[model samples]
Target chain A: MPFSFLLLVLAGLSVIAYRFGVSRARAVAPGRQAVLHSRPMYHGLYVAIWCGIPALLVAVAWVAMQPILVKGLVMGGLPDAYDALPKARLDLIWNDIRNLALGDVVRADPAPEIQAAAETFRRLYTIGNAALTVLCLIAAPLAARYAVRHVSIDLRARNRVEAAITVFLVASSLVAIFTTVGIVLSLLFESLRFFAKVPVLDFLFGLHWSPQTALRADQVGSSGSFGAVPLFSGTLLISLISMLVAVPVGLMSAIYMSEYAHRKFRAVAKPLLEVLAGIPTVVYGFFAALTVAPFIRRAGEAMGLSVASESALAAGLVMGVMIIPFVSSISDDVINAVPQAMRDGAYALGATKSETIRNVVVPAALPGIVGGVLLAVSRAIGETMIVVMAAGLSANLSFNPLDAVTTVTVQIVTLLTGDQEFDSAKTLAAFALGLVLFCVTLGLNVFALHVVRKYREQYE
Target chain B: METAILRDTMHTLSDTHAPEGEAAPMTAKIEARQTNVHYGDKHALKDVSLDIREGEVTSFIGPSGCGKSTFLRCLNRMNDTIDGCRVSGTVMMDGEDIYDPKIDVVQLRARVGMVFQKPNPFPKSIYDNIAYGPRIHGLAANKDELDEIVLTSLEKAGLLAEVKDRMEAPGTGLSGGQQQRLCIARAIAVSPEVILMDEPCSALDPIATAKIEELIDELRENFTIVIVTHSMQQAARVSQRTAFFHLGELIEVGDTEQIFTNPKHKLTQGYITGRFG
Candidate 1:
């Protein structure tokens, strides 16, 4: 039996002990009520967790080390015949033996010594797991008996239980923070490796950005430049255009919903607008590429201006349409949250409805509105699928939206996609771009949080 | 049970309570004739009739949700903001039917200003807070005139000297009392004929309550003031006339002295003597 299974049986016995303790406390202590010290429910839960969590934790520890122990014993038992083989062949034989012990069907051939080692591995697993479980089961009930008997009137069992819950919550939160740190460091490490091979100055400030360096030093026509300026510039231009399309339209819609529209109209329009945000970015990508790009091209042709088929304008406009609900929903909430007292105050001052909204309501909600805008901007910058599908791959660093351009996200996708070797600078450049994007978004989020906090202090 | 029918019955009941406040010795500023108020199917104010005298402090006292605030709000058309609220009969201001379709709510609010139960000052500079009403109505020609209006209004509310040096500070930074006074100043800035207060001292401390009470006494000489209060003693001290309401009906109306000292209806008797308010 595993340590966990033994602990599980101990946990059941602990509950029985807890119940006996409660009945014993009632009988010995001379209380009319059957319950004493803590509530019956709390007592049961307390004993159960004590019997379970700690011993189960040790069971986990024992399980983690089991493979290492089994491997060691098998290696020590290997006959001298196996030791005579080459390291590769010996490793293969050991691998086969380990697999055979686990009852896995492995392809490699095993010697007589390897087979003997496999038998020893199975025997050790049975002895170790069963011994651990049986020992834990006996230990759990004894501990439960001690804890239940010691629970006095002054003992803060509830507080201890609450503290345990708090620890669990903190641990879960630490996982998220740890994962974020891990991702950042991974990006940093890969980006640093790429920077070592390609100059940082060139990657950051060079005008030409084409990463097609050959593995063979003497190979002809495989040399490449690695300027990231074009990608950055393209990202900025596209983001600006998206904001241009999204901000006013979304804000106006929010204002209409909050102020002018009736409840019936608001109920219909708000969800319809939110549906825009819910549509997948892939759908947006296809719409931008197939429908919007050609439209922009023809419209530009009519105006006698040349327009690329995969123009940033097309991609940005579609991206803007995709993000409008973000602006509308958040702004609508902020605007609606502008207290009814504020509106009433303005109205009572001989101010018209529009005047009240413009001077009083909007000013109160300004910080929230700014924070919403920042969130929208960061979303636009980090957006990948739409730009990847619609925006062209060529890094044309220009302010003109009608030109074909590429963002850092699009390049990052193209750089690492397909079966590329991880050690290559091209693949690692993706991590460098990811690091930059993460920093940008993180900064935006922090700034937004600050603004929102300040806003809350002012109004709420 | 519908609000419309309640108002009709209230008009008949109003006669018994009509002469409560010395019959407005000067003249009636705004009079409600057989006017009733309702929110959805709930009869908030029964067909109630009363005269708000020019330059006099009149108060309506009642238990919680007894429509004291509802009646005060009707003077300035503030109830228009509530979706299901309906008013019948007529609320006349200076012989004009304020409830008529031709009347503009914004104009009515300007003519009849209100100070809410909670002090809600605009989150702007002290100067701008007072200047808001004047600016919206275009009461001033230039920055100098606007500055003058702000100072005069602040003076009227007795907040000018305290806030004079810190005119640009955010109005929200002020204490609860000062914020209420600032709201008062903002109301007077528009120079309305009447000032309606809805339990103005409910959110204030004792000292702030006394100051506001003093301001109300002084304001009675210039503006028609109607205050709503759950506090009977405060109503007795400030208001010349007092109206007692019980369960959406005006039980009695009389001079504060008479209302406090004498008995009229069983409900009114039950209320003042602390039998069951």
Candidate 2:
């Protein structure tokens, strides 16, 4: 039987078990004098969990073990001469047999012994699946029957069912946490491999970055210099420019929305501001490259100044526009969170509206605004697409916004995009860059949370 | 109930007669004539006419949502901050119409300050909280003058001795009663002619309440004060005259002694005797 078909049957059985459990609970307490300890719904859930969980566990375990057992039986049925062959050749033959059993085309004509092994593999797999299906079908009803018998008036079915749900919720959250840990561990191991080939200090502090290793033994002019200072500096320059544009604009708009704008205007404008955040970054990339970069170049030449066709200014300016909503939305919420009593106090002191906002409202909301700005800064540093399309790939270690520069994210994308071996230093550098970027962003998020928490404690 | 109505009419006749009959009549610092307040669709205060006497603590006593606090807010035009709150008719301060279009509310508020039910000290240092008003109104010409004003305001509010050492500490860090006093000091720093307090002791304990009442009594010598209170005893203790409000109407206004001992209005009598509120 197919795995999905067996799962469907088990699900149907659990539903029937739930109905049976409810009826049994009703029957057990037929007299008016006898009261139930838990609700009928809890009793039904308790029986359903008992029926489904054990069968699901058995199904998972069977699926996990069947492949190994069937592979072992197939190997045993092969000739004794196969055991003397090398491990690689033996693995290739096993793969051929398994493919042939699944009715796939094989690489070459198979030997008679190999053909016999394929037949055994198919028979063993079929029998194992059939046995799993039968066992699950029987086990579900038996567990459910035991649960139904325990559904007495004195049973604490609610407590038992709630405990099962708690465990399931914990397992669900663990999947997300474990996935993050798994990704970090993989990045760490790959970065370690890259570090073995290149010294950490050189990669961190070197001024030049050229991640092209020699493809041939005697290839010339392909020395891979993995200096990362230029990329870090570029990231900082772009982020700084973006913050300069985003913070004042975003904070002013937030202040207007919270303090001055009428209610109807605020209701209409806030969502429109957030629409900027929903635009795809790829669209911003094309906008930066095709429109803004050329405009900057032409405008700079008009002023008797030189500007790169792909300048950091274009990408930084566009990215700043992209991040305005992030800063504004968070700031608007925090500013609105400032108590009305505070504004009233200032107003009663005979202060004007601007005075009240400047001296009272903004100061009270400063910590939350700082946190929002920090989050925007991290987002700017990690932004890739706009910089890739507009900011040139030249690793110029300059602070001038008009000069072309590249960031770590753009560099990582360039290093790993083409056909290449994973073992090369060029490809591994991407992992190293990824690890550093992750740590930086993680640190920023932690600091931002700390600031926001301190702000909460102030008013609370 | 019939006799109470008869006495109420008789007392109203005597109230009009006594003021003209006395040799020294108290001047009305603020006069509201035919005042009505509307909050969106609800009629909050209706045709209320009253006078807040000069240099005396006048208390407004009523149940919750009776428009006593609403009337107090109107003295300083604090109702302007609320959306859709409409005030019709005249509120005259020293014979000047406060709601006139030419009147700058900032200047009006500078002359008439208010304290809220809750202690709402600004999130600033104690010294700065008091100095905030004087600084904004340009009342002080220099740092030394500002410092003197802050010190005198704190001294007048009776908080200088308790918070003298922690002058730089945050105003919000003070105790509830101390914070309320800090707010009073902040109000005094601006040197307003009148001070309106709306249930200023509601968030405080008995000891804090006693302290604030004492402060209000001392402040009456320098400022015209209007207070709203839920506690009848607080009104009797801190005010020379008390006005009773029921629903949205002013039931009666008289000397505190007369209102407590010989209330004419049935609603005022029921409220004072704890029969029904």
Candidate 3:
């Protein structure tokens, strides 16, 4: 049977088990629900869990083991000469046998022994699936019967069902945590492979970052420098510019919304401000490149200043606009959370409205604001599209915002895009850059969380 | 109970003549004339008129939502902070109409300071918390003068010795009673003429409440104090004159000893004797 069809049968079994469990609990108690340790639905859920979990586990194990067993049986039946072939060639032959068993035409005609081995493979698969179906059919009813027989007025079905759910919840969280661990390990492995080819010091400390490695020894001037200073400086410069733009504008707007604006105006304006965050970064990239960059260039020429068309200023400005909602929304919440009693205390002390806000409210909310600004800075550092489209890809080690500069994230994207060989130092460098970016942003996020937590403890 | 009521009425009638008698007459610090307050459509305070005397500790005692706190807040225009709250009346402070638009509310608040039910100290060092009002009002001309003000305020609030060593600590780190005293010191740093306390000791323990009550009695020597309290014993202990409000109306106003011993109104008597809150 198809996997979905098997799932449907199991679902039907669960429904039947639920009804049986509920009726059995009621029959045991007659008309009294209070005599039962838990609600009737809990007993139903208990039966359904017992029926579904074991059958699903069996089906998973069967599906996972079937292929390896069938492949072993098929290989055992292959010609004796196949044992003499190398592992790579043997894998190719195994693929051909699988294709043949699945009724697809092979690239070339296989030997008679291979064709007979395909027959064995198909037969074993059929037997394995049949046994799996029979096992599920048996296990579902047996587990449900056991649960129903054990059902009593004193049974704590709720505890058992809730414990099972808690295990499931823990397992789901473990999956997410393990995925993050897997990504970090993969990045580490590739970066180690990269450092083996290019020295770690050269990658971290060298001044130039041309990643073109010549394919042949005779190729000239393609030794491929990998200095990260220029990228680091570019990231810092752009992040500083973005923060310089975002923090004041965002904080002022937050104050106006929280303290000054009328309630109706705030209700309408807050969501409209948050809409800036919802606009895709790619759209911001388009606006940065198509509109803001040229305008800056023309304006710069008018002032007798030289400005690159794809300057860091354009990208940083647009990125700042994109991050405004993050800083403002969070700052607004923290400001609003600074307890009305604190403001009242200030107002009652003969302080005017502005003094109360400046002296009491802002100081109370400073830690959360610092955390929010740090989070925004991390976002600016990791931001790619706006920098890619508007900030030029030249790794210029300059402090001038009017110059073209490339960031670590932009370089990672450029190095990894399109067809590439993984064995070369060029492709592996992307993983190394990703690891650095991950570490920086992770540090920032952790610090932000710590500050926010400290602020919460202060008030609560 | 009937004889007690009759005796209270007689005492009130006789004492009514004593205030006007004249050799050294008591003066009104704040005079409210037919004050009306509304929150949207609810009549919170209805046609109330009373006088808060200078150099005295006067307490307003009533159950919850009896408009006692509302009337206390109206003294310094703290009600202006509440949205949709309206106040209409003539409130004369030191013989000047405080509700007049030309009278800056900020300066008025400086003259009439307030302490809230809950101690709300700014998240600053204890020294800075006390110095906040003086620094804002420019009451101190220099750092030394500011220090003097802070020291005097803390001394007056009876918190200086306990917190003198930890003046740099955050004001919120103090114990509940110490924090409340810190707020009181913070309010007094600017040297306001009157202090409006709305259940200031409600959040304190008995010992802390006693310390604060003692502090309020000492403070009455220099500042006019109007307090609103739920504990009748607190009003009887700390206040010279007591006003009993019930259902948005002043049922009786008399000397504290008279109000507690011989309340003129039946509702006041019941409330004082713990019949009903």
Every model's TM-score on chain B: 0.92, 0.93, 0.92
Question: For every candidate, what is the interface RMSD in angstroms?
Answer: 0.7, 0.6, 0.6
1 or 2, which is superior by DockQ? 2
In the range A314-430, model 2's lDDT, one tens digit per residue, is: 999999999999899999989998899999998998999999999999999999999999999999999999999999899999999999999999999999897989999999999
Candidate 2 CAPRI assessment class? medium
Evaluate model 3 with DockQ and give the value.
0.75
- lDDT of candidate 3 over A65-164, digit per residue (tens): 8899888889978878889999999999899899999999797878898889888988998888888899999999999999998889999999999999
lDDT of each: 0.85, 0.92, 0.91
lDDT for model 2, on a 0 to 1 scale? 0.92
Q: RMSD to the native, candidate 3?
A: 3.4
Error of 1 at A307 (Å): 1.5
For every model in order, the fraction of real contacts preserved is: 0.74, 0.65, 0.74
Candidate 3 chain B — worst ten consecutive residues by lDDT sum?
Answer: B16-25
CA lDDT, candidate 2, residue B3: 74
Q: How big a share of the true inter-chain contacts is recovered in candidate 1?
A: 0.74
**Candidate 1 segments whose C-alpha is farther than 4 A from its true place:** A1-36, A71-128, A145-156, B1-14, B17-25, B261-266
Clashing pairs in 3: A206-A227
Task: Tell me which of candidates 1 and 3 scores higher on lDDT.
Answer: 3
- For model 1, state the Cα shift of residue A428 in Å: 1.5
